[model samples]
Target: MRNLLIFCYFLLFFIGLSCKETKKEDINITTDDIEVSDNLQAVTKKSKSILFFGDSLTAGLGLDIEDAFPAIIQRKIDSLGLSYQVINAGLSGETTAGGKNRIDWVLKQDVDIFVLELGANDGLRGVPLSETRNNLQAIIDFVRQKNPEVKIILTGMQIPPNLGVEYTTEFKKIFPELAAKNKLELIPFLLENVAGIPDLNQADGIHPTKEGHKILAKNTWEVLKDVI
Candidate 1:
């Protein structure tokens, strides 16, 4: 009887030791899995995001949310299986001054690229070219100050012929000047191919149609693909 009891005790000790070792191995595997998951999440978060700042032109004015230029660009990126998020900060009827006021809010996001598309409404409203320029320059300066590494893509706007040749010329110069000064990628005119096309524009003759939005997306992608 004494021998049997001793044998039982030894058996229990070995079994307990094996169980403890098994548990430790499981814990280590679980910890490794958690660490891998965390690292993958960090990589996903570091992917690029873009912010589109402009007026109705960028807002898709009369169009649906999915039809907006920002959304269009996002779709294009997704189709290519690229990781990107494009936030549209466009406000209808917003001028350069409005953009200046709201720029801080726009920069609050984790933005990798900023597509500055303001001053179009300023030109439309006949706002002074200097004020428009100052407002736009201030916005660029503020953004650069906050994030020097953030890429900027400046999109130009053209005034209607009714705005007159002299005013139009000065208004058009604002984008190039700012782009050159800041060393930004410039899209000479956002509506280059679609602006005058009757079928591409909405009845208002200001905003672009769905097809027009696609063209604008292509224009943005031309510059964006290289950077991101």
Candidate 2:
């Protein structure tokens, strides 16, 4: 009976020790999972982005990507101690119709400020003025739907008079009209100091040169600083 009692006690002791060891292993696994989850969260947390969406002009045609106005704007933001990322979603040859189609994909990430520089290609192509206006309005609406608090900076663009006087006049009015209707900040003529200047333009006479982009950045900064 004594021997049997001792054996029973030893068996109970071993069982308790095994259960404790299993619990410790389970705890270690849980701790590792939590650490991994925390690391992933830290890695994915990103700064709010100032998205520059437009065409070849915004894409920095005939210039280095870093020389683009959007990148220059990024430098300005950094200098001001702002915590914002600059995303250049500019595509060469993109028109208002294309922009309307692409805005959804471009806005997949969080955007704090949207600097819209489209409609130049649309005007140059002589696309219907009403269609261009509607497409631009749609893009703006989509951005607002994505983030109701997003601030928009619409940049005005002008084309040569080859598209007929009536078309040119109406095209020029679109930007301000949209700005007024949407209550958005407007940069009248993004190429104010650079347009019509030989030195400021590329060989194609359409896209702005590196020096011209500096002036463009200044124009954008003037209106952008007020909004942000």
Candidate 3:
């Protein structure tokens, strides 16, 4: 009778041990699942942000936010599985001086890439080419000082033919000169494909239309892909 009681107790003990082992296995699986979830979330949160700091050209003046060049670039980044955010800091009628004035405010935001596309309005307003260059240089220096790692892509602009060849030539040189001096990337001209195309321009030839914005996005991406 004692032997029978001992056998029954051993059987119950073995069953209890098996149940505890199974529970431990379940807990380990749950822990692994939670860890994987946390890792995924962290990856999702570390996405990069690119800032498009320019005039109306970058702002999509007449177009919707989604149609802006910055937004289009964001879409490309997403399609390519590159984690990025494109912040539009464009202001219509903004000159190089205006850009310089507001650069500090723009820098307060988390900016990774700054697509500097000023000077067009300055050229249009007949601002001194030297003044334009000075303003742009200041803005570039400030940005570099604040975030050395932040990439800058300078976009060149040409003055209207009526602005006289001398003035236009001087205005044209500002971008290349600054780019070379700062060792920054240059887009050459933001309106390369769509500048003079009547169909690409809105009522005012100064600002680009929706179609023009599409081309601008392509121009930006060509240089941006390299940096990203």
Candidate 4:
């Protein structure tokens, strides 16, 4: 009986040690995750903001988010060792009016640079030229109001004349006019070489493929390098 008791005690002690080791391992794994928070805070503190606010093109549409122009831009920025954080605020199918509506909320964060890429959907939907212009203007006003020092970049867009030639011509002029009036930088057209290019565009021909996004990043980086 004494021998039996001894064996039982030894077994219980070994089991207890095993349980404690397992608990300690779990704790170590949790600690490693917690350690990542320190790095996150450092990154946040060091990074400045470059906000891309626009529609589906900015959102990447059918492509993977990483294949999106904004992410490509992010990679470019990182490659250059720039400290700017590229925030992709693109909403699929958003119009200038919708952008205006959300401008205030979007501006809650500090924006060092703002890229406005809206109005394409409005043209496609045949929204009035005046309304689109007004909405875009309002978004610009709100952005400046939020941060007067923020440098704004306006991206021009052209639509098929589903509405009419007159409407199409007027829509094309809106971006340049706004850029001139606001003294903001302009991209001329967001989808320059990629647009209407069968190989560059996806099957739908609206969004760009991975190769196309590379061109987009190049287009943006051209103007972007000068600014930053």
Best by lDDT: 2
Number of the top-ranking candidate, with TM-score as the measure: 4
lDDT (Cα, tens digit) per residue for candidate 3, span 1-228: 999999999999999999999998777557888989966764576477788888888888888988888888878887887777677888987888889989999889556888898988888888887898999999999998989888999987887777899998888988998999999999988898898889989887767787788899899888989988
Candidate 1, 1-228: lDDT as tens digits = 999999999999999999999998777457888889966764685387788999998999899989988998877887887777777899999999999998888787557898999988888889998999999999999988888889999998887867899999999999999899989999988998998899999998878999999999888888888978
Q: What is the TM-score of each candidate against the true structure?
A: 0.79, 0.80, 0.79, 0.83
User: What local distance difference test score does each model get?
Assistant: 0.88, 0.91, 0.85, 0.88
Instruction: Compare candidates 2 and 4 on lDDT and give the better one.
Output: 2
User: Please, what are the lDDT tens digits per residue for candidate 4 over residues 50-145?
Assistant: 999988888988888989999999888877788888889999999998998888888887789999999999999999899999999999888998
RMSD (Cα, Å) of model 2: 8.2
How much is the lDDT of residue 33 in candidate 1? 86
Please count the clashing residue pairs in each candidate, in the order shown. Answer: 0, 0, 0, 0
Candidate 2 contains a number of clashing pairs equal to 0
Q: Return the candidate ranking by TM-score, descending.
A: 4, 2, 3, 1
Compose the digit string of candidate 2's lDDT tens values, residues 127-152: 99999999999999999999999999
Model 3: weakest 10-residue lDDT segment is: 38-47
- How well does model 3 score by local distance difference test? 0.85
